[model samples]
Target: MPDHQYLLTLKHILDGLGRKGGLEDNLNGLLATMARELGYVRCFLAITDTEDEDLKLSLSYSPSKADSVSYAPGRGVVGQVFENGETVVVQRISDNPNFLNLAFGRTEEEMARLSFICTPIVSHSRGKPEVVGVLSADLVMLPKDELEGHRSFLEAVASAIAHQVAILQEELAVQKHLLNQGMAGLPEAQPPKNFVASSKAMRLVLRQARQVSPSRATVLLRGESGTGKELLAEAIHAGSPRAERPLIKLNCAALPAELVESELFGHQKGAFTGAYQNKRGLFEVAHQGTLFLDEIGELSLDAQAKVLRAIQEKEITRVGGEMPIAVDVRLICATHQPLEDRIAQGKFREDLYYRINVFPVFIPSLRERREDILPLAEFFLEEFSSEYDKHIRRISTPAIELLSMYHWPGNVRELQNCVERAVLVCEEEVIRTYHLPPTLQTAESSSTEISLSFGEAVGKFEQELLVDALKKSRGNMLQAARDLRVSYRIVNYKVKKYGIDVKRFVNSKSRKR
Candidate 1:
């Protein structure tokens, strides 16, 4: 038997779970609502890791206070409830030996004075109820006799959470099945193909992408055109929890201004002149997945406003519809255009810029990460060779030098096109400089005294000197530094500064042996 306040809190949580948002949002809402209403000092939800079956702290009211704690099944009170699928109530947490108190960082005195309650969150699996997680709370002032009542109330909340999880899981399964069946207009939710990141700069970018992938953080990728911003977005999606769902991509600059809103937020039947039937928007299609917007700086101010609202509210209103539809999407935006300049010129909304800029990943241009150029070129050569049915065994040294010397203005995409063209033109076993585009040859010759500041010129010279030293020493940093007459520390600093990956040279030297 639950009290009036407990029932009201349970109802609020159950109702909040139905509104459109991410599972994390709904779970946080439940925790916050319950904590506020029940006077809980702390509340936490721990879900069993799919791979390891260990209890992972998924959500907490005081997130910073919650450490990255994990528990084996039946290890702690929370774990016991999850493993045994039972309710646990400790009148005083310190008296219970099973209470590990791993996350809260509470003192023994504080633990002894507080009451603890944990409930198992169970969901149906193959028509059988299975425990999926544990919901636990800390109460500072609740009487010992009231522990049973609080336990019952928490059981209700856990049930509500389990129900939501079941719904989301079912939806995800259906979406995956539909995608596998090759549903029309839906992008395949395939993992991103392996991308090369041999350069330190590119590796750092990949690290950042991996770090932010697990969380539902809005990522803004800033880079020059053809720098693989879209590729990085796909990698983020592949590494995310929503990898099984659709990853819808749209080039904002490619769409006409009149259709931007309609494309993003679908219109109802007869909503406009061309509204032939009710259609789902990209947001809806990308639910539980990712929406990658390339050239986002091209969005109109009106469109930016609408997008901002959708991001803020996790809901969207169709172009002509008044009702708001819930959307659960991880937004990954990319742009070659300078958003700050657009904001200064009133072409982009400042608020929207700030919102999307939560996790900004700057991808270095090909010129900046020159060490990756040869690897990327080789990769492209192999890919194009396979595609064109050519047995181009290797790129000639002269051709490699030419590829390295020419400043790739169009970056990776330009390099890929160049390699494809070279593959198509070359008739022999190897690709030579002659097989390369005439523009590259002319560009290399004409750019002898390339316009560069004194510092840039010195840096380039240092990088070239370091590369030559590393080559002479067969990628031995200590030997290279000794050959260059510099300390190992200085050489190491210079290598990192130039975004050089010494491992590639080291492996090359090893392969020679």
Candidate 2:
């Protein structure tokens, strides 16, 4: 029962399918046939949708009973399949407590005696490894002699089922094909030039985003206001195969309750007052692309339901239109508030939070990544200076020092505005300390909360921040140094002064100052 031998036999059977009942029907019939032949009591085939909205259970055949039931992806064995892209083979399904039983009227003990095996079907269409759906087959009350043969047989049968599923979708003539191209571990393209992130905090976010970009998972972007959630959404969309297509952005909080639904789900002509013509909303416009729903934490419970349905069903019903319009769009959502807390308070739906938060990326506030403050200030100064027709060389060292010391609660957006305002009014080529906002100079002079000496306080804070960055970077010494905006020698000196193990943080992955 080697894998290679089994595969050859499978190819022969596929060649034979051309002459059977019908191409498509023969395929399904053979799938079930192989299931029973493999000494299984029943078989089930669940296929994940193109848009990855949810898994559609297509076949369920149980030999013991004549009846079969279809269940949702998150409801039964398929739920486990959707959650983890691995085979769930149970020799005794009833014995396992984690086995969320879907086998009708079967006790845990009874199910345990009946060996179970489930394989996740990774569709070639997406070209990414994921639990697209599952194929479940089991043997009832095996006495050990038949168990070995049954297990081997089911694996071969599972492979056959996967091929058939792919072919079926191909034959269906899907107008919008889900592109299979992308870095299996990275984005399809580099990040935006304007979307700057040299700091470790932002780098970590980028890393997480890339890791989940290729998979069929809903992305939940959590951050404070003006923390570049929309920018991150754009990065995700741009780095996807759908990059060439439209990126539909919806400010969920910007629209009123009366119009939010219509703005997102579209409405027919005369669906409501001011519906002068049939207007497609953000969702419809971004078809075959990405839909970034900003401020999702603000969505009403009723609005939350519609959004969840659109994600779960891969189809949306317009405000007035009864017929469901199937959409092929990847969803990337962003929110400025803590959605989990909101869910607890009942302001946001728990179900929607879970649905959208398949992969969550947290954008760190500017205060957390203070290393980027000076660079960001300079970049903005250059941008605004050029726009305003000024020849601003750069900020003076004292001015940059002042800018760096300020705790920007308003984050990068605030820094950009500050730099712009300063550049517009400044006279000299070198932006001086006086040109900076008064708050910055005040913060630089007396922002120190600790009563320790000037050097002592800075030393203590820098050492602690560097250590935290090292831990977050998984002991990458170079990354830690770069994150702290310090030289390698300075980081090494601190390591020795603090008696910290230098070898522990050895993986260097960043440039020196």
Candidate 3:
């Protein structure tokens, strides 16, 4: 190949890497481009297995062969290049005794006529260079004079591949670190307060939280019970400028209607039967800070009127006191009940609802963001493992499937309790399905017993079958269709109808690579 052609081939490979696809797809494209441009009869890309210290063939390109192969360190020319972190070139395979012919299994006569070049894909990490993989190709039709040029070209290609791999490795490392931090209850800018926001719904919630955090906006967090509204409120306070100040929390539903005003607006000395001294209310304590009022919908009508007056005036009069004391407080309110319905029933004041609902943030339930289930489970597992003094490493695959399939009606709080219980009952390093609550197991069985029309049942079965097939085929629709003994068109139509994201079935490791 000419110098210009070599440059073009390198450019093509780099361009493919920039495209939206997994590492394996880009690598296969690179191999095919090399073969088409340089006339290589066979090409192989192998990376070292860190655990086993062996070479595993990750990709292979050949016109007549589809076999995947591996090599032990120093077993063949490919292994030798990787082991030595240097390039190897054999002008004629017959002349080089080191050529093992392990990859292609070419006969001795065929091998004698072939020219081979193998180069180490080396990367610099922490100011030290390390061989990450081997890139090798065989030239069966090129002249001897072109052998040196091709060897240099292969070395250049190896350098490009090494650069791409290093970038991907760095990204994977960052993801692993972030996941660890989340599981360990560390804060991150993207998700906020160790919350898992992998699903689009949760991410939108995070974005809103971040946007509203810097201001003094009164945020009303709306979500079902156990949807982590308190966590979200804390996240907002933590992100706010007044984060250093105290964040006073009160549950209106937990307090009696008679004491609500005293709990919120403070009490003068001898103001009530239980009051022996002057007592500061949450509003006064949270001055220049934040006050998180949970179950706001449960506030009594008189309490609501007083709360509304305090919010509007930015001042509160102590219970049984005539004078009002000024306060500067950021308010965050949460309620699972619909305040509008409460207003219709004349249980809640509309004015107070609008006052607290100025900046509403709706947190989706766990069942709504199903994609986040596994991450949240892992996070809870880590927390519970530490709490129980156990060395739980992971959740078993069957347990994961069970957790994912179940509808979490009680949301994150429920998940946290379930994981804690599992950790207490678990005996081994892994959390198995048996360790989970009986309710989870019964959930799956209950799902199957639901009443449905024949058409609905068949559609459900078809969707499940297609999903299983796609998972088995690693998101390859054509392969999934073939596995199901159906036409590709039908499979594609059903995939769209069922709103499936085929890419989700693809191996996440492949994308990270």
Candidate 4:
């Protein structure tokens, strides 16, 4: 191979990375480019799992039998390169004992004519060269001199794409972390106070919040209403160095448009009809602390200008006064509205948008993070039960199913209100399906439940009723049958049909009493 061909291959790899596509697609595109430009039959990119220290195949030039395959450190040639943080070249695949041939399953004849080269993709983002992944390719056996040069070229390509590969590795790490947790697993780590992050989406949001908390960079929280943008802003503030100082919050939309400037920047005495005395604005009040502006998109163009000036200059002028007051305050803005659309409509300033979007963290809606619904519901249940002086202990199975299945359009706020309403009307210790709002019980809301047929729904309800009766009767079939207004034979048949464990309910009753 000529030196120009190697340079051309590198150029093609760089071009492929710049194409518009997902990380996986772009990475696989790189592999495809390598296979086409350099006469290689197969190319693979394997990412190292941060938690488990295993090499998992992430991208392939051609479809292979390695979708589920992984190599433990030092287990195979790929693993050896990853473990040693060095490139490995096998002149002939058959000659290398470390070549496990587990991923591709190539025949013995094909192995005889192939040469292998594996290079570690090292990242220096942390100020140290660390191997994050491995890139390998197969080629027809080349002259020894040319083979050495090709190996160096492969190393160069690996170095060039290390940063991108590291980003992909971080994403994979987050996903693997989520998958390792049981579907219903309780959160083990205590996140910021009052923060519930049992779901993957919330965990990701929390991670972003924590990472950006230390910096004075402006953070824009974007999400639908009731998605806890304000809560997240508070979390970010509490984790920052400004935690000891005041965290002033202002709802930009809640204030009257005329009073928005007065509320934000304060007004000198007699500045307006309502300004009887000079009042310090939130910026001055939040000196050396943090200011959280909720519904920032609702700010008028004039207010946006002043806010942007304050952020850029780290100073603010009184509503009616000219002297600029220096304020050392970190800014966090939250908005459910699309700022981009607001800018397009000429309602918002583009410069201000860019400034506040320095570190934008999108808070996912409740529907997107369904795993959090139960935990959040329970949290609210405990709070409302205490406030109302009730003893609501837990949500019933049917109620849990309903809560999980419903699409919470209003996000956490709506869920909180729903749970509070249930607590107020729930007379029993356990909240049942009937206690939930009727909106959640609607056919449209619960459509995600496998599009349950009429008979299946009825049978599910019957089984729940039977289980409830058995719990009340301490698993006494005849007593439960009487309580449910059914005969013992029918109750027995339903119990068998639903796979109800009567003994467990009896044990629960015994423990409760």
The CA lDDT of each predicted structure is 0.81, 0.70, 0.80, 0.85
> Where is the poorest 10-residue window by lDDT in model 3?
181-190
- Which lDDT tens digits does candidate 2 get at residues 1-513? 355654555665566575534446765665566554444567767666646546655556665443344445655555766667666656677665666655445655667578777777665534565454577776676555555555565556665556556645433323223234334433443456566675657766776665565565679898888788888887787777777799988888888987899888889999888888988877889898898888888788888999889888988989998989988778988888877788889899888888988888899888888867877887798788889988877676656766777778778888888898899889756677678777776644436443457787566655655655676566777777887788888877887887777566556433211
TM-score (all chains, Cα) for each model: 0.52, 0.52, 0.54, 0.63
lDDT of 1: 0.81
In model 3, how many backbone clashes occur? 0
lDDT tens digits by residue: candidate 3, 33-77: 999888898888887665467777767898657456767888878
Clashes of each: 0, 6, 0, 0
Error of 2 at 279 (Å): 1.1
Pitting candidate 2 against candidate 3, the one with the higher TM-score is 3
RMSD of each: 20.7, 19.4, 18.0, 16.1
Ranking by lDDT: 4, 1, 3, 2
Clashes of 4: 0
Q: For model 4, how does the per-residue alpha-carbon lDDT over 465-509 read when each residue is reduced to its tens digit?
A: 787788878889999999888899999999998899888777556
Please write out the lDDT profile of model 1 over residues 148-226, one tens digit for every residue: 7888888878776785654444434444444554542333323244376656577668757756776789999999999
Candidate number achieving the greatest TM-score relative to the actual structure:
4
- The C-alpha stretches of model 4 lying farther than 4 A from their native spots are 1-72, 75-192, 445-456, 478-513
Candidate 3 wrong stretches, greater than 4 Å: 1-192, 444-513
The residue ranges of model 2 lying beyond 4 angstroms of the native Cα positions read 1-189, 444-513
Angstrom error of the Cα, residue 447, model 1: value is: 2.5
